[model samples]
Target: MPTVPSANPAEHLARTVDIVALLERGRAMSTPVLRAAVDRLAPPMNTVSSYHFGWIDAQGRPAEGDGGKAVRPALALLSAEAAGAAPEVGVPGAVAVELVHNFSLLHDDLMDGDEQRRHRDTVWKVHGPAQAILVGDALFALANELLLELGTVEAGRATRRLTTATRKLIDGQAQDISYEHRERVTVEECLEMEGNKTGALLACAASIGAVLGGADDRTADALERYGYHLGLAFQAVDDILGIWGDPESTGKQTWSDLRQRKKSLPVVAALAAGGPASHRLGELLAADVKSNDFESFSEEEFAARAALIEAAGGRDWTSEEARRQHAVAVETLDAVDMPEQVRAQLTALADFVVVRNR
Candidate 1:
């Protein structure tokens, strides 16, 4: 595994702290507005959404720390700062983006049959999919309300971005679901699919930041491009990590994707390699074999499959892809008319994007 850039740790730590503080303030303004709108839409479920949002507990009691990492909002803020503006200029949009993201994740866990999230039982797992779906709806409504609360003028750029990104996310999810039954897929196509699914949102984060930062259309577009490429690179890295990452630290089982027969970037690349293990990967894909039977296969089976990915140049291909996208991210950051120190911080963050070993 490639070593994580030292810059990443530093930037992540600093950004995380700053973002957490920012969220603390944003929540105070945004949450009440969100709750009111949600209540207006689903008076019956108003209580449920409130509980899920961490306004209360299962018993409808008050609670804390119900909010998630708020990474999308953080990205929005960062994009604003990168463009030489105060981060909170994008506050409403940032909160909307985050709510939308969480909304998706809530439904995603239910659809994927996932039980855990953020170190706890997923909302669906605890509350059931029907309720979870309602919560998702609430999230969307809250997001839209947040956009509306930004007022006609303040909402112009941010709402446009949120709408575009939400569409991209739907398209990406459609493509991902379509891939489940697909037999023939290319690495390039997979990149496109994931780019829409994963890349669009990240792109939205940066784009919103720029738009709210009062950047010109050109600079905003550049920031959007940066987000798009970064999103792609991040997903590519995630696909790699999904297969090889340590279950203990990554909180994912080893070969989880293999077990699911997921045609992730590495798996597709291995199939394209056409070596001995490549042939086996083809056989497995063709025949629909199981990974729990991994021990039953040839002693060389696991190693051979991994070798096929390497031999077929899957890792290198992915690494190059990451580097390429990261270059775009840096390019966009550089193009922003921000202070040198601010730009440097963004650079450090760009490097951190694809430098993970996890």
Candidate 2:
């Protein structure tokens, strides 16, 4: 577990606490509930989901593998604590958000034709696209079932929030896929798409626990705002990693976003910068769009495009934007009334997102 980079002197105490331990607490609490939900799926769906969750190998044998960062679940639990409820009170919300997150991952991997995730074969590559779609749908439905079965008003409220976020997530994915074919996508448009795709779900995760704990709309909304900005910061950093992160750290090929021609923050910002490097980068990208045979691009070609994108200031602009969003996220917390310890943890989590290497 790597140390979380501290954003300020005030965060020193929280920064000293291991973020991995915080994430593990979320994973440990949610795994049993998550597994139970998945177990309810019939036949191959259950088996396939187990494999996707890294609980089992493709052969159906048990094997510990990368599940995920469990960031959402951690936030969920902390949100409950923020609302003066026990962490266990947030388990259902934690599991539900995790379900929704994985559901998107399944569909996104298939839609993007990504063959690997977390250093393992993706569900689509291992089982087939049809199975991937079916399992993703099942997980989504199970998420609703888990919450609804609770039969509490809070549960109902949380479900409504989760469904709305899921819809926005879908919308974001649609926009993302469409952006790939278009020659020009404005930075504003990209931010809107990302807000829908990544921000919505994180907003839900950040607030759903509090919703379940019976927090008022005002508190929930403020927390959601915090999460929404944090998501943007998270995505900005992710965009950086997608283009510049090491293959070993990112678990993807070099110039991964470039190969996919994703109109991510860096690309869009660079295109918007309007200079010699920007013009050349746009021309090269346009040529790729015209040819549209991204698979044929060599390592040298991808390297050249990446260099142009940086020279155009895409990388630097996005780095600054990440810190800006992170600051805004932390500021939002000031408006909420919560325990100082929980607030520290949330601030630390925000710091983790901006500084995470992978």
User: Best candidate per lDDT, number?
Assistant: 2
**What's the lDDT of the predicted structure labeled candidate 2?**
0.91
**What lDDT is obtained when candidate 1 is compared to the true structure?**
0.68
Q: TM-score for every candidate vs. truth? A: 0.80, 0.97
Model 1: CA > 4 A from native: 1-69, 289-312
Find the number of clashing residue pairs for candidate 2: 0
lDDT per residue (tens digit) for residues 254-279 in model 1: 56555445677887777776777677
Scored against the true structure, residue 225 in model 1 reaches a CA lDDT of: 83
In TM-score terms, candidate 1 sits at: 0.80
lDDT of each: 0.68, 0.91
Candidate 2, residues 112-137, lDDT tens digits: the string is 88888988999999999999999999
Candidate 2 ranges beyond 4 A from true positions: 1-10
* Candidate 1 residue pairs that clash: none
